[model samples]
Structures are given as C-alpha cells and as structure tokens.
Target chain A: MDNLNFDEPTRKELQTFIEREQAQSRYNSTVQNMTSMCWDKCVTGTPGNSFSRGEASCLANCVDRFLDASIFMTKTIQDQRARLQASQPETF
Target chain B: MASRKEAFMNTIRNEIALSNAQELLNKTNEKCYAKCITKPGTSLSGSEETCLARCMDRYMEAFSIVSRSYQTRLARERDASA
Candidate 1:
C-alpha cells in the first residue's frame, strides 16, 4: 500500500468519488435506523402474512413524525438559546 | 494508473454495499427472532418456522415503507428550506 501513490488528478477524482460514496452510505444507515425504530413502534402484533392497513399507515406516519419531532426539538432548543442570550446580555 | 484507480473505487463500493447488506440482515435477524421466538424451545417448531418466515417478509415490507416515507419527508423539507 505504501508504494501506491496516485497522481494529483487521479487523487482529486478519487476524493470526490469517495465523498459521494460516503454520503450514500450515510443515507442508507439513516434509512436502516428509521426502519428498525418504526418497526418497533408500529409492528406490535404477531407477524402475519401481510400488514394490516392500520399497521402499514402507522409505519409510514411513524417515520414522518419521528423526523418532525427531531426538527421541532431543534427549533425549540435554538429558540431557548436565543431567549437566554437576549435576557442576559451582560452575563458574558 | 487507471487500473489501480478502478480497483480502488470498486473496493470502496463493494465495502459499502457489503456493510449495508450486513446491517439489514442483522436487523431482520434481531427483529424476527424477537417476534417469532417468544420462548426458547429445544428446537424451532413448525409454527415457529412459519411465523419466522412471515415475520421476515413483513419486516422487509415495513422497511421499504419507512424508507419511502422518510425520503419523501426529506424532499419536502428540502423544498421548504430552499
């Protein structure tokens, strides 16, 4: 491996390729994480041949609502920080 | 040089693919086992095998549903922010 030195152009190309692959891998892991989390929340009953309508919809909504909760919490934290900074200007 | 670059790229691609596959299999194993095997028996009974098979299919179906919903929400959020 030590003797394998890529030229400048090749290096740049590989850098972008690796970055793209890394982003894809991150996306995949996020999907995997949400799948398991939602499965636990939605699929409580015993396994059947197919999902009931209620279970299917619950699975879908679980994913959306989880993201919504995350965004809501982030906004709330930022708002709280702003209020604190505004109220205690001289604390710095 | 070109051949070496190709080899390197293929290695990275295969590694990522392999990891994603392993993660899915691990999740299926964990979830299906929990669902289908409520008690530890000396062996997997006939009904338990049926349940496990159904459970695996349903888990995968649920996974796809979650993936689609998440992707749609992400796109919507991106549009909103943009």
Candidate 2:
C-alpha cells in the first residue's frame, strides 16, 4: 500500500486525512458509548413515540453528569498522586 | 493503482455505513422484540405488529434525542476548556 501510493505531498495529504478520520472514529465510538449508557438509564419504560418530560430531562442530565463525573474522578486521582508525592520524603 | 485506491476508499466508506446501519438494526431488533413479543404466540399478531412499528419509530426518536444531547454537551465542554 505504501509503495503504491508513494508521493511526497500526496502521501502527506493521505496521512493527514487518515489522522482526521481516526480522530472522528474515536469521537464517534465515544458518542455511541454515551448513547448506550444513557439510553439504559433514561429509557426504562415501554417504547413510545414521545418521551415523557421526566425521561427527556434524565437523558440530558445523564450526558452532562457522566462527563462531569469522569473529569472529576480523573482530577481527584491526580490530586491524590500529588499529595502522596508531597508527603513522601526521600532520604536515600 | 488509481482504481485500487478508489476501491480502498469505497471499502472504508462502505464499512462505516454498514456499521452504522447494523447498529441501528440491532437496536431496533432488541427494542422491538422486547416491546412486541410480550407473549410467545403461534404467530405474530396485529397488536404486536403495531407495537413493533411504533417501537422502531420511538427507538429512532430516542437515538436522535441522545445524539443531540451528547453533541450539545461536547460543544459546551469544548467551550469551557477553550
């Protein structure tokens, strides 16, 4: 594949296109995961043409809260690591 | 070489489309089966057919709602982080 499509500028273009596509693919999968998670939490009742007000709000809140929780946990872990480093002293 | 490249591009596009379609189909099947197949009858009845149709429509609606909600959240996060 590389040998067949070898040109300086064209190769650079294809590489960038591939990178963009890879990023989009990752972004898409994240969305898919979020959808599945939120759907399970929010859409518990029998399927209907319209969602009740409570269900709609739950769906919106689910996404925001999930992302918030993820960020908060990551920050908490980093903070704990920093605290540990600060507390431990090296004498050796 | 050009034809091969075209073929490769076509394959990628087709794969992406196929996966998206498969995802929709699976969601529809699971939701519809749950909603419509309440009782294992000798055959599919009229009410079950109606329920399955409505269920598919509702599933698509749920998909759109979730998609919008997530997209908005992503945009808001980007703005805040920026």
lDDT tens string, model 1, A1-92? 33579988988999999899999999899999989998999899999999999999999999888888998999999999999999998984
Which portions of model 2 show Cα errors greater than 4 Å?
B1-7
- Model 2: pairs clashing at backbone N, Cα or C within 3 Å: none
DockQ of each: 0.87, 0.49
Best by DockQ: 1
Clashes of each: 0, 0
TM-score of chain A of each: 0.91, 0.90
**Model 1 bad stretches (over 4 Å):** A1-3
Alpha carbon lDDT of residue A26, candidate 2? Answer: 72
lDDT of 1 by residue, B32-78 (tens): 99989999899999999999999999988988998889789889989
Model 2 over residues B1-82: C-alpha lDDT tens digits? 4566667667776777788778778867876797679888999998788778877876676667777877898888789999
**Per-model fnat list:** 0.96, 0.40
